[model samples]
Target: MIRLDTGAITEIALLAAHCDDLAIGLGGTLLTLADSVPGLRVRALILTGAGTEREGEERAALESFCPGADLDVRVLDLPDGRTPVHWERAKEAVGELRRGGDPQVVFAPQRDDAHQDHRLLAELAPTEFRDHLILGYEILKWENDTPRPSLFHPLSEVVARRKAELLMKHYPSQRDHDWFDEESFLGLCRLRGVQCRARYAEAFLVEKATITFGGA
Candidate 1:
């Protein structure tokens, strides 16, 4: 089991095309990180949410999900479902955010995802963040598209359950939908955890990888 001493990571950034994309994709992982570290910083960059109802919902949800940490949220008014068309703007926005200092880790979508927006974001991310670690979180909607994830982080059952609860509590828009519920979220975590023999887990697809060994 990969027991990450989350205290080691001070800053984390998550990039997504929509409001719930980050939560749906890496909510459990984020929760685990927050719990593991006392002063971890987190940022969620939403490429869409331009004058939409989802924008307010995202704001509320993020505040609830990440309580103590410095939650930096930037909702770009870019057209939804058209990230590939406006790739330059997306890259520029990301570049502007990481100018002063870079986040220790960044989580974004896979380059070959079913959704064009996700794929585009993944492509643009590399342009700005060439040296840092980039993790691609998966969303199951468009299709059960799996990209052979290279990194897997196990979340405690408590963390997994809390992630689901936060999703339900924060997103009122999704509650009416048949798919948004406590059971399905837990089920997904359990299933992913099975891949690494953990009770609950979140998985990521990686475009590049680097590792250094510190003697145990």
Candidate 2:
């Protein structure tokens, strides 16, 4: 288990457009948080993939990634590639998730991502989670080709391997694609890890945060 020596963050929500997006973007970080903070709850709100095989894959993947934690896997029925077409419904779905509780940290794709669905989700996050810290995960798409991510969450080698295993085990839809292989996951983590002097890491772009120099 990867132990992070830190205080517990109240909650964390991983918002993504697809099943593998959460795993590909912040799997390692999720692992670290769950292992280190017993109070931590990881909720994944997949904006798309509602009535598809991908949604099943996402459910299984989240269970494996966050064991013994509060895990809520929701698939908003909004059509893929048409989130903009149903903006109100999408916003209502997200707002419903943000109703009972608020997370200390929220993760979503960058607004500049190549995918229109991702961009729309990022834009919608702030509207519901205005009081929380928001971090945008970079999707390796054309628009985010040169993402200068400002935050790095280091991952141990073992956790990195677990991430790869979960990816392959849960998401079989992208197995044929070479880019979704274990090698690619490790490569990206290693590249980001270099910035933080760790064997592996996940990069994130921070939108806003409340910082205290010493004491809160």
Q: Model-by-model lDDT, in order?
A: 0.81, 0.81
Q: Model 2 clash pairs?
A: none
TM-scores, all models, native as reference? 0.90, 0.92
lDDT of 2 by residue, 64-177 (tens): 877767888888777878888988888887787788567888899887787888888899999998988899997653343647888888889999999988888898998877
Model 2 misplaced regions, further than 4 Å: 1-7, 141-146
Candidate 1 CA-lDDT value: 0.81
The candidate that wins on lDDT is 2
lDDT of 2: 0.81
- Expressed as tens digits, the lDDT of each residue in 17-88 for candidate 1 is 988998888887777667667777887789998678889889887776666777888898888777778877
Total clashes, candidate 2? 0
